[model samples]
Target: MECCREPSCRKRGRWRWRWRRQSGSGVNAEEEHGIKKIILIGTPNVGKSMLFHRLTGIYATISNYPGTTVEVFRGRGSFENQLFEVIDTPGMYSLLPLTEEERVTRALLLAEHPEVLIHVIDARNLEKMLSLTLQLLEAELPVILVVNMMDEAETLGIDIDLAQLEKDLGIPVVATAASKGWGIELLRKRIAEYVRKHGVRKGVG
Candidate 1:
């Protein structure tokens, strides 16, 4: 079932098995009405969807972006008493918009102006993915870094100094293996705290 020679296709195929194991019909009304907005952006196969499911406790509602075939996922979740509207954008390697999917994601980011933007990255490819993080920071967007797939990185003998990475990036960084449910609680805490401190809009009770 090779879709194409693109790396994204291969990665998506590799994780197809996990998709069947997922439960829940999709996002619910409570999750849909969150006051704060959190957008998850990352390259394909970086566990962005898995993290979204974890945060929202439901599968994302997949829909085509306006006037485009590209799909974006949206759901809602609560953390530390803060309700958040979470958007899992299509996989994008850069904000430069080489593909239609990237173009949609780039437009979504600029237009939504979310209270907290979470950039999920593969732990094994940290250095490579940091370029996008830098791009986000350069744009002056509120960003939080999620170093996902730590379990795989550990299996490959990669050790990340999360505190150091957080200091270097000058933003909150959370280490997690979203598939295994590791570090999700901490990630939730960080998201809640970040929003409370920097959120532009007041949370709706």
Candidate 2:
């Protein structure tokens, strides 16, 4: 498993997200780091920060739709023997900029050029939340949908066919109960695999 530590491979997975550093490729270390960013974007109260904490193992400040992530939070997650910088952007409902926070989050997305954009959504609210997902896909960005709060959905008898959703969206979909630590390992695996599949060995600088 080139992506993970040998010992952790059993639990982590075989493939990993890798950012190549070649001296003559004109790609400096800082820009290479930029290529390693994993961003989380979605509407408010969808367990975005919970998923972020599970991925990064860091405590993030949570609120009830504060709507201003002007001061974003980031932490590192380790999988496949490599570390990924994960970010929690402010809540945004559409690609069209409306509020200041949405504009901030939108600008950051274009500026950073992240390796993977994980869109966290409440599994029970898939219909309303999916429009933003479609918009992200229309932008031709690499996006993975995280169907979070499955435990709650299950309690409410809400069933989501993840495989079908993935096939229909033409992107990766991972169901997670971030608060309960479900599907996190698989989430990590998918993140690594997505980066490896999409990223070409070239300069991001």
> Cα deviation in Å at residue 37, candidate 1?
0.5
Among residues 3 or more apart in sequence or in different chains, the pairs in candidate 2 whose N, CA or C atoms overlap within 3 Å are 3-80, 4-80, 4-81
List CA RMSD, all candidates. Answer: 10.8, 10.2
TM-score of each: 0.81, 0.77
CA displacement after TM-score superposition, residue 146 of candidate 1 (Å): 0.3
Report every candidate's CA lDDT: 0.81, 0.75
Q: Where is model 2 more than 4 Å wrong at Cα?
A: 1-35, 59-69, 200-205
RMSD in angstroms between candidate 1 and the native structure over all alpha carbons: 10.8
Candidate 1: regions farther than 4 A off? 1-34, 201-205
Instruction: Give the C-alpha lDDT of model 1.
Output: 0.81
Residue by residue across 52-166, what tens digits does model 2's lDDT show?
8888775333322223536777666767765576778888999898988788778767755677899999998999999999999999877999999999999999989899999
Clashes of each: 0, 3
In TM-score terms, candidate 1 sits at: 0.81
